[model samples]
Target: MRAAKGAKGFKIIGTDGLPGPAGGIEAVAKGGWAGTFTYPTGAKEAIEMSKKILLDCATSVEPTVTVGTTAITAENAKQLMGK
Candidate 1:
């Protein structure tokens, strides 16, 4: 993979099959807060692009686990507070 100039951060490498002569390596390195994707020569760019696409779908707030008929909303909060 081509390394960017004066950059430093973590890298995430992914591959479909075995890492041998038959199957090659696919790597992606992302810098801190910059949010960029890179790939090696002749390698399919879809994998790298998919990372950004998938990350775009990510949410800062995690999903809440609800059970039974428990109500968790502004109205519920108000009722629970006896307001």
Candidate 2:
């Protein structure tokens, strides 16, 4: 995920790509809300590039966490939510 402080508030983005499905989420941290988008295949590169842009925006505001498959499990989600 990536996060940045926007003119209105902070923004966060999350992305993932799987064999037959791909999706991403863009979030505004100020109100703890988000929106999502999905694409079947051809837009993979664009999705990835958008993620990079979000990360770049975040770099100026806060640290970012980028992890592979193993770290995004239900157990981890629970742990993070607990904090």
> Against the true structure, whose TM-score is highest?
2
Q: Which ten residues in a row have the lowest lDDT in candidate 2?
A: 17-26
Off by over 4 Å in 1: 4-6, 22-83
Cα error, candidate 1, residue 43 (Å): 24
Question: Candidate 1 lDDT, tens digit per residue, 1-83?
Answer: 34644455754233322222222211111121222122234334554445545877644333332222222232232232221
lDDT of 2: 0.35
Weakest lDDT window of 10 consecutive positions for candidate 1: 24-33
Scored by lDDT, the top model is 2
Cα lDDT of all candidates, in order? 0.31, 0.35
lDDT string for model 2 (1-83, tens) is: 32443445554333332222122221222223343222235355556656766865544432443332322232233222322
